[model samples]
Target: MLRFAPSPTGDMHTGNLRAAVFNYILAKQRNEKFLLRIEDTDTARNIEGKDKDIMFLLNLFGITWDNLVYQSHNFPRHRQLAEYLIQKGDAFYCYCTKEFLDQKRELAKANHQAFRYDDDWAELEKDKNPHPVVRLRAPKEQMGFHDAIKGDITFAPSEIDSFIILKEDGIPTYNFACAVDDMLYDIDFIVRGEDHVSNTPKQILIHQCLNYDKTMQFAHLPIILNEEGKKMSKRDNASSVQWLLDCGFLPQAIVNYLVLMGNKTPCEVFTLKECMEWFDITKIAKAPARFDIDKLKFLNREHFKRLNEQDLAVLLGYKDSAIGALAKLYLQEASTLNEIREKVDLIFAKKGLLLAQYKESAKTENAEILEFESQVKTLQDTLLTMLNQDCSKTEFDTFKSNAMQNSGLKGKAFFKPLRFLLTGLAHGPELSDLFPILRLYLKDIVRN
Candidate 1:
């Protein structure tokens, strides 16, 4: 089984959610289970109801972990493992006080060197302090592991301190709890952000001490950078899933865009099931991924094109069939739910079509009232006729030619004002694409 361990300290950021998605995809493709382990060992910082928020967000993206675990519930096991390491001498109790350590660190800094915990209690074999902490007995040489994306990553033991496995308060440190939790759960893979690369050595050391020279894979996903290439944070609107939901971005579009980021797949759009079928751990990019809002909007627009008219109507919250028919007229140009509603709402009440928006352009184009109005009327009538006749593209082409010839109008003078009448935009879906759907607006054109 694959497991995703997210700390419920705050709202679910896009980076953490992406990691959950990767693990979920891998497990689904393999027909195995994806497990959820909430790392809530730090109760001091825990916000009430944040765990539910995490689960809610997970389900929001359609991610369903097979097994749900609370790391705090496994605290006894975590402490038991730490004690096991101590009894085996793979870890030791340190009586080093915080003040003593700080003084040593400052002195080392002054001398232009790094402080190494020399296990000062080792030679003396004396319990010199009131509060003692558990520390791992790390190797003096290099510790190396194979990362799915980065290949081989090696860290010198000195580069890692003989960090605390269990705190003075008898609580397991994050690394200790995380490693033990994964092992206890028998997770087949550990997928997380590359920022946690430094923690791997410590976890692996703990794993080795437990005699679990694990075959479990470690896949460190790339970081998601902001527009400025800085790491994404709460300050970046794009990093918040809640922000996207509130803005009405389709969940499928978000999933599609996220899967494409740092993914080797050339595809720009996919359903969740399709993504599961195509996900490959080794194909994830080693480089950090940048979060581009424009890409997301593009995907959203692509999804808009695939929506059925009725579904589009429901999304726009329109109950009237007339508005429903017109709602789809805007689908081809709309990239968001709000945009679709805005377009339909414009035509819903005739008062909104005030025609005032056309004043400047109409004056500039002479409103082409006499010359272009007749031509547009002809085109509109011809489109209505085509829709009634169920005509082909060839027939529409013939009508377009006749309208242009009869109007003695060509270029912007002809097309611009006509476009303004059909839709307010100067540039949009081609007139040809609009013809079949034009039947929806015929009565309005005649009355206006």
Candidate 2:
């Protein structure tokens, strides 16, 4: 059995949601029990309604946990274990404050010393008046293990931090709580993000102290990065999973994309069932993958193209509305939504229609496409004259050569007004195409 433990601290970020999806897939693959455990140990950071949102999001992806548990309910178990470790000399109390630790760490960093928890004060007895935090008795020997994915990782005792297992506030720390909960849940496999690699030695030490099974297999998946090769943070637009949903991404497409983060497979696309059948622990890549928004967009667009209009509506959560109306307006009657949506997107660029399409065959036409046709040509002639006056022939030619070359403009000084003249939208299809379309419409209008 496996359990997904997510802290109710913030909105579901990309990394966190990916971990959930991975766990769900793995559990389903092996026909094992999967559970959801809310590790809300840090009471100060817990956000309201986030836990519910997590459940809602998981349900959206068709992942339902076998059991649901909260760490707050298991505080006594953690404390009992911590006390037992203290009695066995596997843990001790520390009276050091945050200020003392920060100064020591800074000095150690300056001196090139291992700026980790030294446990120099590990031998200190429990402070009677003011309660002391319990520290894990880190072994003074090399601690290492072979990761299912990363493989053959070694960490010397010097690298290990004698971290706190229990805080002075009498609440058990993450290391102690996780260790106790894992045992209680009888978790067979521990698959999580790579950030926890450094914390593994301590977790193993806790397991050893409890005399629990220490042979559990482990896989630490890679970190997600931004386009700049830096870690993708919450501040990044693409970092939140909800942002992708609001932008019209299908949930299945997202799950499919995330599974390939540290995963290796010959085939490009795989369904959940296919992923389960082909998922190999040994095949996961050791290096982290940068989250490519373009690749994600491409994957999403492919899925969008594949869906029938009805299914697409359901995926987009527009199931109750007039799907056939939309299909007729944007899919059937028209060659593509990419065309009308291109026009509508200007009202939103790039973002397509939100409302359902409806039939309007009986509607009377006020102005013909011709009326807008000559207006478009007149606008272009005015634009050309303005461009010649504003810029040198070389610059004008550079801008005219390709619409993409317009990235040279810092602002919308070039494209903004032109879009207004064309479609009353800020941006749309290529300027070159628009000019020609307008010319054709104008010729028809002049003939009429």
Candidate 3:
């Protein structure tokens, strides 16, 4: 079995989806059981309706699961196992009071030393410290494990202390509940972010002490950071999936982009079916990846290209063929649908300026401007003729050929003035493409 478990503390972010995507892909590849497990054991932080948000995110990304499980549902089982460990001497109860523990921790911090729980609490009388918490009795030897992405990793046992399993509040700690649940469910493999790599050996110790008959495979993904190379928290996104959707990003684009973050190849566009067929866990790198928002928009544009013209226009909320074709020119390079809409909207404004004041930064000299106007004068008749004619999808080349031949000014010298006059931007959706739409108001521009 394979599982995609996320803590329902908040909306599912891109990093969370990456973990879920990997697990779902691997489960499909191996023809194994797959499940959605909500690790809602941390009830204090678990937001209401967040689980549904996670499901919505998974559905949007086209990752499905056969079963759904919540860590909170296994409270009885977790407590039972903790007791079982106590009986087997693999774990013991700590009778230290909250005050004593806090004092100990504060004393350690005061002296600039790490706090490790004293085992003397285990020997304390149960009558005096009745509300004790159960803790794992860590072994003294070094531990190591094979990770699918990280390769062989080793850790010194000295670094681990007697960590709590069952808290005084009767809830099992995340590590304990996770190990117990995976074992009980007979999970085949586990896929999680590399931040949890430190917790693996402790789980390994628990499994060994329980005398588990089989071992499961593990794959740890590298950390995904914000574009600035800092940790990507919920603060970076408005509300995770909703933010992306509001930005006019297609779900398929997001799924494709996330998978390629850690993957070896640059296959930026993929469907959910395609990902299931081609995604390989071993190819994921251990090095961290920065979440480049620009790249997401770039991939979105690529996916948008595959849409038919009608479908493309419908998505952009435009019905006019001239505008649709004009938008397609812009969409060809737009990273997001919003970019196309914003530019198109500006060009279609009724009262806005048509001829942009060329920025001093454009370094456009008065002599060069006059030269361009003189050259363009030769093509006024040809351009007016084009305005009267119908333009097919391939008509951009026809327009380009006539303009180049008549004015004898190709590339930037020819296109920049037209683009500036029409769209007020140095670069935009193809000029030939924008011209057909611009022809609707060409008298205004040509008259100016």
> What ranges in model 1 sit over 4 Å off?
121-129, 319-328, 331-333, 349-448
Selected candidate, larger lDDT, 2 vs 3: 3
lDDT of 1 at 129: 71
Regarding TM-score, does 1 or 2 come out ahead?
Answer: 1
User: Candidate 2: misplaced stretches above 4 Å?
Assistant: 116-129, 314-448
On residues 94-148, what C-alpha lDDT tens digit does candidate 3 reach at each position? 8877777788899999999998877776655566777788999877899888999
Each candidate structure's count of clashing pairs: 1, 0, 0
Task: Residues 397-431, candidate 1: write the lDDT tens digits.
Answer: 66556556665667765676556555545566666
- lDDT (10s digit) by residue, model 2, range 265-288: 767666566788777767878887
Give the C-alpha lDDT of model 2.
0.68
Model with the higher TM-score, candidate 2 or 3: 3
Give the clashing pairs for model 2: none
Better of 1 and 3 by lDDT: 3
